[model samples]
Target: MKLRQKILLLAVAPLAVAMLGIALAVRFQATQLAQHERALVEAAYLQSKETELRHYVELAQSAIAPLVRSGRTDAATRQAAMEALARLDYGPDGYFFLYDLHGRNLMHPRQPELVGQDLWTLRDPQGALTIQQLIAAAKGGGGAVRYLWRKPSSQQLAPKLGYVVAVPEWGWMVGTGIYLDDVESTLRQLDARAETDIRQTMAWIGVIAGISILLVAASGLALNVSEHREADAKLRQLAQRVVQSQEEERARLSRELHDGISQLLVSVKLVLETATNRLRLAPAEGAAVAPVLGMALNRLDTVFNEVRRVARNLRPALLDDLGLYAALQHLAREMQGGSGLEIAVTQSGTPRELPDEQATALFRIAQEALTNVERHAGARRVVVALAFDADATRLTVRDDGHGFDVARMQEDPQRGIGLRNLRERIAALCGQFDIVSGMGGTQLVASLPLARPAAIAHDPVSAGPSPS
Candidate 1:
């Protein structure tokens, strides 16, 4: 993958995983909590139903209390108590029932057809003896039994909670029950609502995650674009600088030829013309013409020297013939004589032949730094140090001059052209260039790596004062 795509993936993958993990954790916690809530709610609802059923059973017993307390075991008293219970009810499906010890239905206000019938063997759809369980609950000093029975209102067999009590005086069982379908319906609604809320929460999380990922992607894209634009600008600026440097060099050469060599050639040409005229006029007096020819020969020599100087400036022959050290030494000597400043060349480590490009780049970097020192840095002494190692070649130029602000100069195109050229030269060779300047002085170091080197012992070298 491309570097940008990889970076985007790195930025987004972890976030997506974390968001999904958060969603899963939330769902897990919410599901567990919902289940717990359902259990608590169902328990609370059942407890309330039990309480209401108990109250209803107690009210029925209270109504029949007169007969039992008066010691009346007659059929008419029992019939009157049953009729009173049959009339006492809270709703359409709420009523009392009666059964004797033998499980014979005595009174059932809701199911009148079941009255006076033996229903001991009767079972609900789940194969539970409904009457037997109710009778057993009554025998156990009034308790509740869960069984299936037909709901009086719907005529559908459903789960019911029956609270029963025994009237020992008449050897009869009496009970009432509340069907559980409505409780289930209410809990189902709660479950559905909870599910909806959970789904909504998940959706929100998904949306937020999507937005966050998109934002990260957008930010990365913006950053890449900004960096790309900056790189392009820098590239264009470097190209311009290269062209400018070439033009400046060409202009300098043109001036040298016009003002130095061209003038000398003109003098030589004039002296030759004068000498030719004298020789033509007095062919027999050749000794007199020798002086004119000598003058012309001297001018011709000066013009040749000027040509050599310009050619040396173009490409120093020492760089290809002798190596970087010799070229640097020659440059130092030339700069010292021209600038009338103290310049020194120092060498350390094992000096070895370098690649042509690396040698040229290092030389140019030193040349520019020295030029800068000569023109801008008003210093008395300058040190140019070259070091070699198994891994790389290093060049250092230091001048004890009042230094200018490095950042300020680098930002100013006119002031920074030389520095930028030096930097580009090193960069083209896949090297590093650094400059440090302060009131102490300016130091420029350029490091270029050799492609490969033979195994050789490295020397511990340091830069110090130049030899007087």
Candidate 2:
């Protein structure tokens, strides 16, 4: 994996996990909230049903009280009472029953067959007394019981809220109940909604995970490509440097052979000429040999001057003996002689000596710049300026030439080497380099930190010759 992929994964993995965790938490919270809301609704429904049932029982009790108190509680009166109770429809799935204080059923709305049956003898499959408990409570005081009730015939379980009231004058108890199965239907619907929400949240999590992985992969690929390009550029720069070093070495050797060996040969020729002239006047045939020696001498002088010029061109001794300014002046003068181009050099502020590496780097940059100007620029005027300000040494070279496009040159790898090298050299010195070129002219500017040389005893002679 590339570094970008690693970094992106490092950044995104935690977030993805956190998002999933949050999604799960949110889903759980939503489910809880939905359940809570459903519970509240069910509670409300049950409360409303309880109120309606209580009102219905009160109405029945008030209607039957006058007949029972007047001692008209015969079979016809009881039948009228049952008819009156049946007319008040409490709701569907509701039941009404009347029982005596002895726990015997007096009347039941749906099951008249058990009218005289003792309810205290009734037992559910769980072996629990059913009607006897409610009769005892009603005989003591009116109360209600909310419990699971089962139908004797079908034995189906259903939730019930039962209310029992005592009628001591009639020796009877009254009770009513309603089934709770309808409320459970609403809960089932709520559960279905919660399940659907969970599924949707999981789908969103999957989508987020997929997008995060794709982004990480793309970022990694991009980083790998960028690193490869940088490595290639560094390799090309190294190769260029190798080629330049080889050429420089060759130039140095050529200069050394011509300046050292050629000069010695010319001196030997001069000595030979003096000997030939003296022998001609002596008793020897030196006159004929003297002309040949003269011709040799003339040839030797030409060769010596050529050799000295070539050596100086390769690496000027004045650069080492004198300083950077003097060397530049000499270079400008020599270039002016050969190219017939107008060149000027200017300096200002204190002229302090620089380290050997710094001086050499600056000189080489200037040399390359001038050479490029000669080959590419078709102008007659050039200016090289050096100045010192505060702790910085600045150099500027400007040429009034038909300058090429700077942007294009920078993009062209083939033509950009010189500028790149110059930038690298300045960067190595913790300096800055900038170039500005257009159709009108071009300018190269560099600024280096003015590092003071080590303190040494000043010698007047050591200062060397000044610029002419």
Candidate 3:
């Protein structure tokens, strides 16, 4: 390998390692962060479940409250209350259960066989005597406990969180429980989603690292590739801004035509009418009508001048009538009026009549390029070049003024407005767009293929004379 190639490898290898390290670091941080978030998600689920269980149990209490308070201790009254609670069911696997002070089930809503069963000695998988603990908690004013119970929906053992309360006058406990498996499943789903997002982030980091490793020799371009995503986002926004600007310009032009040129033409018309009336109806003759004729002629001249100015602003006549070559010449002459800048035009190969879209795009690009140069390029001279060949057309505008950073301008909305539009225009034609700039000078280059035109005229922004 050449010395340059070897040195390039040495520099690239470490950068590649560093990038891998960063990817791993980011993955680790994401995982740790996601784990903490998972706990919060689980906590939120648990808290909500607790609240719902309390509400459901309260509903059961409300149903049984009237019966227990009726000032009657008859066995029939107790059976009525038990039967009423048993019929109460809200959702799937949701119901009320009752247990006597002695540990026999009173009203097992879904499992009637458990009514007479002795469950005080029955233990869950965790070896906790489930009924005994619940009875103790209920007797001690009422609270909640966790254990394994058969799910009413699936008849499978599942973790449950139950709340129980005592009926002091009736020697019974009433309670309800919510299945905890739902909370677990929800937490698991969140954890799975978090893992998927982390994998995706790691994938993106790997892609960026792989790219950096491959292009270490062109680090600036690599950095620019990362920056290109940001630029693409801005480009989408610029597209809308460019459209709004064109519409605003069109509205301004329309106003000027109506209020400025239209009024002038009306004045000119009135002047000619008066002149014609004087020659026909008045006694004045010869030199007497000469002054009126001269005044009419001056008004006509003013109207003609106004029309040309508006026409040029709408779409340069030279550009439409004479083609790009003559239009560019006119453009240079216009910019050199008061500006301290010398603009030059050069062409190579033969100039042909391009389609309206192609000719217009080239002219507008040059017009905008010159406008930017005159406004920002504090240079003494600028060169506008047009080149045509068998396969493509190219236009370049270079300025000797203190050239600004092309990359910086592209990233900044205020600075890179026209250059961006020039690029989009050329690129629409399946062409290449490039800008090379430094402290000494800046050059904007665009090339369009001769293949059947692909670029449509999207911008109507007349670059002839921008409004102040």
TM-score of each predicted structure versus truth:
0.74, 0.56, 0.45
Tell me, by lDDT, which candidate is best.
Answer: 1
The segments of candidate 1 whose C-alpha lies over 4 angstroms from its true place after superposition are 1-33, 60-89, 95-152, 155-175, 199-236, 271-301, 350-353, 389-392, 409-417, 424-429, 449-468
lDDT of each: 0.86, 0.75, 0.81
Q: Can you give the lDDT of residue 334 in candidate 1?
A: 96
In the range 1-468, model 1's lDDT, one tens digit per residue, is 999889999999999999999999999988888889999999998888888888899999999999889998988998899999999987888888999988999999989999999999998887889889888889988888888888888999888888999999999998898889998898899888888889999999999999999999999999999989977877778788779878988999889989999899889889889888888898899999899889988888888888888888888877776677878889999999999989989888876656667777888888878988998899999999898877788999999999989899887755676787788778877889999999989999999887443522232221122234
- For model 3, residues 1-468, the per-residue Cα lDDT tens digits are 955567667888788888888888988898999988988887776788778877888888888789888979898999999888888887877888999888888888788889888787898888989999999999998888889999978989999989898998999989988888987788788889989999999889888887777667687556556667777877777877879888999998888888877887788778777777877887667567777778777877887887887788678987766667778888888888768679988887766546667778888888888888877778889999888777777888999989888788877766677677778788787789888999889898878777454433333332222212
Let me know the TM-score candidate 1 reaches against the reference structure: 0.74
Off by over 4 Å in 2: 1-213, 219-223, 226-234, 237-241, 244-322, 348-353, 449-468
Instruction: Give the worst 10-residue stretch by lDDT in candidate 3.
Output: 459-468
Given candidate 3, what's the lDDT at residue 222?
62
Clashes (backbone N, CA, C under 3 Å), per candidate, total: 0, 0, 0
What stretches of model 3 exceed 4 Å from their correct place?
A: 1-236, 251-263, 266-281, 338-340, 453-468
